[model samples]
Target: MEGFLIRAVVVGIGLWLASQIVPGVEFRSTESLIAAALLLGIVNAFVRPVLIILTLPIALVTLGFFLLVINGLMIELVAWFLKGFVVAGFWPAFFAAIVVGLTSWVMSGWIGGPPKGRIDVVTMRQTGPGRWE
Candidate 1:
């Protein structure tokens, strides 16, 4: 999907920034960097949602701040599966996750207004004298 690839590239940019700024996170090669980007996107897409649902109560209790932990966990999980992609500890992952998440969000917003690549629109029709649809 075009959306998927676009997301991956955005995340790859974040990953590159994380590698430079986050001390404990590193990519031994460009291949590893790219692969980690793709894997991170996959983990966030599939695994993060289930984790969020399971931790919904805590997330609500924390006023949504706990989602940062979920984001960190997703980064760590990606690191677990990918060689050369290292998250030294929970803190490092947590901060790097913040960087990655913010980077992706800002980049996506700049690329278009949203990640979907299209703006939303609505149409209104008059069905009757005083009714609308």
Candidate 2:
């Protein structure tokens, strides 16, 4: 879907930004960078929900801070599978996760524009004969 592709690109940009900002995160090539984004999307889509469910109690107990741990764990999983992508350790992955989230949020908001919640006064009808119209 269009939305998914946009999100992948945002995540990819976030990955690149994280690599630049965090010394511990590294990608050997552009191919691996793209692969990381796609893999990260797949992991977030399929694996994250199950992990969240299994670790719900711990996540709740940690007042949702453990979600950051889960995010870093996802990065570790990515590193384990991808040959060129490397997350140095838990802290680096954690920082990368933060970067990814912030980048995605800002990029998506900017690209997608404002939310569809505002009233459009120009589109209102004035065809009625009543005084209220």
Best by TM-score: 1
User: Global lDDT for candidate 1?
Assistant: 0.89
Clashes of 2: 0
Please, what are the lDDT tens digits per residue for candidate 2 over residues 78-133? 98899999889889999999999899889977898335687765645567675333
Candidate 2 global CA lDDT score:
0.90
For model 2, name the residue pairs that clash. Answer: none
lDDT of 1 by residue, 66-122 (tens): 999999898899889998888899998998888988998899778973435668799
Q: After TM-score superposition, what is the CA distance of residue 53 in candidate 1 from its true location, in Å? A: 0.3
